[model samples]
Target: MTELLKPELYAVVGTMSAPLHPSLKGGRCMACGFVFFPPQRYGCEVCGRSGDCLQSIALSGSGTLIASATVHMHSPGARPTKHGVKPLEAPFTIGTIKLDDGPTIRTIIVDANEPSLKPGQRVISKLVEVGSGACSILDLRFAPAL
Candidate 1:
């Protein structure tokens, strides 16, 4: 069975063993109508409402690429990981994406040719394997939608 890399940050559509659609774990203010990503219990930034006013929500993973950049180097030794998590190799790409649901997030972009990517291109959520121990550990990534 596969496992999500960070259950607190995102959720899978179908099942953990075979995730179909990936989405971010977010929050909405019950006091106001503020929606946010990376779910936080702290007071709402919009309404100043406390944790009680926040409700757990799932954010749409689809978005538009605002910008992208590729990292071409890595520090000397292999980076340490918790629980055998595999550190992404250098030359990986990262992108700033604005979700259709109304939040901008910076995250990894896989299966993409960085140089060819253009701003405002549609993107979709993807789960890619990052490690394997007792089970496959999958992490979230964004890719340009064809």
Candidate 2:
């Protein structure tokens, strides 16, 4: 009884897993051989191919920042901090990256705190913790290449 309860307790307090995977969500397209991230839902939206189409594929995570911009205002229903403190200056940078795997995606750049940016810079995706303890959300974010 105690062992069963311990497992349950651990689950309740454990960190949440991310939904996307580099291998499972960003690899070769089964139908067209095109690799992408946030993998295709049902069929190939680009080639219009169907049947035995789009499958979970791995992504290289390496990409070039094609374009970027900062968002100064928060959208409606945005989650506030656990301590009730809103971000002092919640500026976020969004960019479309051309991954080596052959697909482009709009992703948040975590290292966008800098005052400036340039196109064609290298970036990599990473999992980031967005909030406190149980209420946290794991999100994909990009950072400048090391």
Candidate 2 colliding pairs: 23-58, 26-57, 26-58, 27-57, 27-58
TM per prediction: 0.88, 0.66
Off by over 4 Å in 1: 14-20, 77-81, 132-134
lDDT of 2 by residue, 1-146 (tens): 01111121112121123223222145455666766556445657668775567665545656788988888886766655444223324578888888766778887788666456679888776655554444544445678876
Per-residue error for 9 in candidate 2, Å, reads: 27
- State the C-alpha lDDT per candidate: 0.83, 0.58
> For model 1, what is the C-alpha lDDT against the true structure?
0.83
